[model samples]
Target: MRTRPIGPYGTAVSVIGQGTWQLERADRRTAVRALNTGIDAGMTHIDTAESYGGGAVEQLVGEAVRHRRHEVFLASKVRAANASAHGTVAACDRSLRRVGTDHLDLYLLHWPGGHPLEETLAGLRALHRAGKILHYGVSNFHDRHLAELFARTGPDEIVCDQVLHHLGDCSAELRVAPACLARGIAVVGYSPFGLGSFPPSPRAAAVLDSVARTHGATRHQIALAFLVREPHSFAIPKTATPSRAEENAAAAEITLSDEDIARIAAVCPVPADDGTPSSASGRRP
Candidate 1:
């Protein structure tokens, strides 16, 4: 339930945010229950996108947070195909309508393609200037893309980069992490539990199990704790169950020792030729 500052924007988001990609397929009651459970557990950050379930997720979020919008740091992304200035502007308006919000705490470029980097940056800048979005970020970007985007837009405008980072996927450590760290950009790590490929490696599992026993937490909780323990790092693990939501929120209080961190890092997967881990293939988006 603790919060972490998301980049230099001074916005403090929940350490364990809720990703709403899977909520699109859930029925109304189920979706509302899951969202309410997350809020009740002190999870104040939620990530969604306009493309998710053709805007169904955003609509559900709107309904769930009708009277509690101020309690959560809501975030959503614009698809790569809608990367132009015009596209982004219109998309942001549409997102606000769907979510029943006037503004977003963070708005991200869902992918790193489909338009010129400058165009995308310009769109984000316009949104910030218009007060439609508080901060701007990117997802699914590589080192080269990060460099190009930052170079064109300057570092201050780029707040964070959401990427796949977990025990089974630590490829971001090679370049993305260092680049963001040096530039003062926060890293939002998605799929912190490897998207259901839990209990990563024997070494990692052993370390996690030991830490869990010490904290009376679950393996998944220990796994998430490992990510948020890093400076300027955040984790968003999706879940539809109330029990799992509470378990994830409890991880914020589970601090890992230096030895535990080193052990977990040692077993993290290495990057492949594409600069992404092999385990990332298991991720749906």
Candidate 2:
């Protein structure tokens, strides 16, 4: 898998990282198998959150990587409700315990909350100084939210913004992703398949299928590879099947031609016209 840097001195994470949202509901053996299979396929970045299955998913991730922690760039998020300095520290400590790791490669604010942004930044700064987390980021943040958060924090303090981005849904491309890229912040795209909830329109499917055929890849890989085409972009596609996990990891190697990328981008859904309404509605903390 191709890798990209999260920070100047930070490790470069696989462009096709593993997303573990709602995986706690999956059978234990199946979940563990999917995660390990991803690792075996050279996917080193694993993302989870304390709120996932109320930490059950974190536990599963812990068990999967306990023996190979050094090979993985583990990441997790603190719910906005727990964004206070005290709560952030304690929450991270618990996450470390659950994930069987000494520290997280990246820690994110799941989303902006009723809590003051100052409180959240303070907690993230404290975590950085304490070395509990190497880098801090945000997920599901719009342009306004990123502007608000970066105003109080360093321009480069944010390592990335994890947003919903794919060929079928490209809200991040318009504002959220450009804002992050301009500031040297990586954009970690989640739901490359729209969480597998929205099936593509025939027009979009045909385009994806054409690209997939050209590259000998699946539609899922084509979708993911397009997102990771930029040096600072990453993709995390979730699945409970080991074969699917392996396939997602291989997407990093499928480089899209400029024309191919342009074609895919042209067919990508825009917020207002996307048949799937409520493009970024789910995954709220």
lDDT of each: 0.82, 0.83
Q: Per-residue alpha-carbon lDDT of model 1 for 75-160, expressed as tens digits?
A: 99998899898999899999999999999989999987779978887889899999999888988777778877777866577788
Q: Over the full model, what C-alpha lDDT does candidate 2 score relative to the true structure? A: 0.83
Give lDDT: candidate 1, residue 34. 78
Model 1's alpha-carbon lDDT is 0.82
Best by lDDT: 2
The lowest-lDDT stretch of 10 consecutive residues in candidate 2 is: 273-282
Q: 80-148 in candidate 2: lDDT tens per residue? A: 888787888888999999988889999998878747888878888898998989998888888668778
Residue pairs in candidate 1 whose N, alpha carbon or C atoms collide under 3 angstroms: none
TM-score of 2: 0.93
